[model samples]
Target: MLGTASPTRAWLLVEEPGPWGAGGVPESRLGPEVTESLRRTASALSARLLLVRRPGQAREDDGVRTLFRVTCTRGRERVLVRTCAAADVAAAAADDDGWTERPGNLLLVCTHGRKDWCCALRGRPVAQALAALAPDDVWECSHLGGDRFAASVLTLPTGWTYGRVDATDAVDLVAATAAGRVLPALARGRCSEAMVAQAADVHARLALGVDDVAALRPVAARRDGEDEALWHVDLADAPASAAPGGVLRVTVRRTAGSEAALLTCGAAQEQHPPAWDLVALVARQLPAG
Candidate 1:
């Protein structure tokens, strides 16, 4: 079984020119001290740390020129900073209000073998395939959690996370994403929203046949019971004739499996994790008075 998809709030990318080995991104490239500092900073900021590099030939240089990108969905911000060492990332992570509002997108394929074998075994091929399709936009990033869902992908700027992806699905995923559509079957959820909102977004997308990435936005979310939540979402930029002020209410219930299993390979067995189930969906169109 695959790992459950969850939402994330932000992403932190660090550029490292590499000839990445089977072990994944070489921490040796970043040096021991800088590596430690980067890990600490990323954890403190609750950011997913990724290693990125421009596709193609490796440049001959003794020192690495790193570029750091911080992506936040709260204000729709993407900030980029250039530095000579990985240790410098701390300062950028420390800044709370320095992100620039812009549209920046990247395809991050997790291949962190040290963290989990499935990631390297299942993720590398997908990354290579995607790179062939969009060289400038694809990258082999570090762990993005959910090792059980190896070959997990995070589409940036929009922060849509997908799991259990394979090489065969790379082309269609890229095409759909480029056309501003979300693939519900493979989609985990957007990192920008909460868990219930993520589930609601998926349900709404499938119900309305709405594909645009930014078409639906969460208006409100609230708990209705100990294990159930309701979400109100608005359909943005819809045709007036189709939906006069389109809105949807989605109900999601939290459920648990009867068995315990390892969340990821090499991890101890644990109680079943909570899973969300879509119970009902209601669409409303306000009268244009």
Candidate 2:
């Protein structure tokens, strides 16, 4: 449960009304060929493939109205394909003309039971709780890469991933999303950046106490050594109280996990997962204006 699940850079979501099996989307109604193809496509793009269902009764002609939504930092792409066929998915995911720059937000809760029981048990309640608060903005989504972090939450349009969340955390999460801030305590990382960058972003957020989602943006990164990296983050449109010429330098290194355990309950005990630790944090002061 201590492993980082923040490596994804993009996400491909397919609408599937189910009866999803124990393995979730992979074993869902979408045939094995299409599922496998999706897995490969996602891997090629460093993205995560997920199955999503809008809240309500399962559609009778689910396959005919399947929706494919691709979200990346560059833009949000969507297409409505008539079938759950693999070829269609490939074309849609690859189609550049279909992508558009639009501002929208969505809360995706991981409730993929087939991937791990904990996700379903822990995530469903949180999803329901959040959905009650923002009915149109929330959806029960498939595996989000962290089975150990059962109640994993992904905030889209920004792709901020949070894990180990509970029903009680819904209010804060919703508020944070609406206000363009992130809760550092549960934040796994931002999907758009590398793990090192993700750590650096969190460090900067804590040091500056800047919660506005658009406040800090990674401008550059450099390697300090094999295990460490320095990230240059620029603060945009910061409040006057934030200080002059806003910029923050964050250094992060890989650290040891507190202990080793299977990342998921269903996984064999032989598997070990690494924990996230902050190695260093420093604020770079700017010259007076």
Candidate 3:
């Protein structure tokens, strides 16, 4: 997988795996159904997703660069897209039939290009660790974080983006997301609007200094003084509060089984508004915490 998906030009599209396609995203990340979920994620944030080469396939774009095209689907319906990334062609090997590939090969990206501090320095280790853990799936990106986050790891099979991830969180994240778990809270930052909401809710709970954050979202905030990012989530029918008989009685472990950062915060909402950020804020006022 590594050999074919060139790290230099591979454009990894990190977004929330959708439940078919409400703007193309899932209601809640599939956790218990890790083995059964297969989402068709898109490069929502970008106008065009970078296409990697198909395993054993290649093409030239106006003679300047080689491109690859491939398709994957949630079920029988397949989504079509392309990438000028040469490595994408080989990323095909990362594909699995489902059950056996929990944590399907990973593609950890450490590029912080989205942020002003996104230098090769921060992205280097993220790339190295991902490569070391899932060499076949890992690809040191050219600053994909698109933010100042120290590190960001996105799972290839699940399209879940665990932000503020540290070298330590790698193992658990790789295992959980690889298995298709819906890591509640932590500002999901998966680039998937839904996931981002999840992350913010979790962060909001942390900020208010409460743990009973039932279906919370950051909405928007000025992080410890970093870029203004956004966060969102939907425990819509959550319990009135984290109390008995409450609609939601949730206990989310922001950290993955591996104990890494999973530091999902309102990283995105801090900078911009998400699809449901406004709704989340209004809901937050209801005193659900």
Candidate 4:
């Protein structure tokens, strides 16, 4: 209300969906789960104000000088509302609320990079749909470092990356993420600091082990669901032993399966264990990402 901004905040209103509001924009669905999650999160955070809309509203600056505007529809009636940003337009979806809800960096990126009819493809639809639904969260990017993946929306708070998303599932994705629920099909996975720095060596390829290396790939991992249990891994490597001169010949493995488990294995590799760290011993016989 006084500073350079108005504390990024969002105001959400529950409404039914209908046809295009005005500009012939498409429609966005507010699936039951998505809607419930949004409400739950908004209530938990005590959100005072939020912009609400249906899909198909043009997500852009229609010329509101002060706050950010993300429009949507209530069955053909074009609805335009102001975003949280009290100063900068980019803070539209934020700046007003107490900053409690997660997905910290809520970014709606448009992956439709190439300036051609293709730009209007899925990327544009995603851009417009998200813009209409959560327009303030819209972002213009050349690329998110992937091919055919036009936009990359980075939900603040958690750095989960989703690719190939479009207008249709925008609401579902946003709502699911806000609820801290894992959208397995949507996550691009997260790699840890240890995993990023690992370039371990293969010490000895043991034959008398409980498991053997088969196929390996660089994977981002983490523990989830009932298995507070770490990931279970299956690895294979060439038969090897300590170097004739002295050193052992082992292969470092790239991991898959669970993230927490992979991290556990990666960490174990550091402790030069005689046999305690099974992951390190097993990893020594694989590849890297």
Q: Is candidate 1 or candidate 4 better by lDDT?
A: 1
- Where model 1 places Cα greater than 4 Å from the true spot, the runs are 1-6, 17-32, 39-48, 53-62, 74-104, 225-243, 258-261, 268-271, 285-289
RMSD of 1: 4.6
Q: Candidate 4 deviates by what RMSD? A: 18.9
Candidate 2 has its poorest 10 consecutive residues by lDDT at: 74-83
Clashing residue pairs in candidate 2 are: 22-114, 180-213
The parts of candidate 3 lying over 4 Å away from their true place are 1-47, 51-105, 112-119, 143-146, 182-187, 194-196, 199-289
Q: How far off is residue 178 in model 2, in Å?
A: 2.2
Model 1 clash number: 1
Per-candidate TM-score against the hidden true structure: 0.77, 0.77, 0.41, 0.33
RMSD (CA, Å), each prediction: 4.6, 4.3, 14.8, 18.9
For model 2 the TM-score comes to 0.77
lDDT of each: 0.68, 0.68, 0.35, 0.33
Tens digit per residue, CA lDDT, model 4, 1-289: 0001112223233222221121111222434354345446545544322222323434453433222222111111112334332123333333344333222234444332233223235555676666665655554333233232334443432333455576687787756654644343443322111222112211122223211212122233333244432322322322334222122222333333232221111133322211111233332323444
Q: Which candidate is the best by TM-score?
A: 2
159-181, model 3: which lDDT tens digit per residue? 44455556666566556545544
Ranking by TM-score: 2, 1, 3, 4
Residue 88, candidate 2: alpha-carbon lDDT:
70
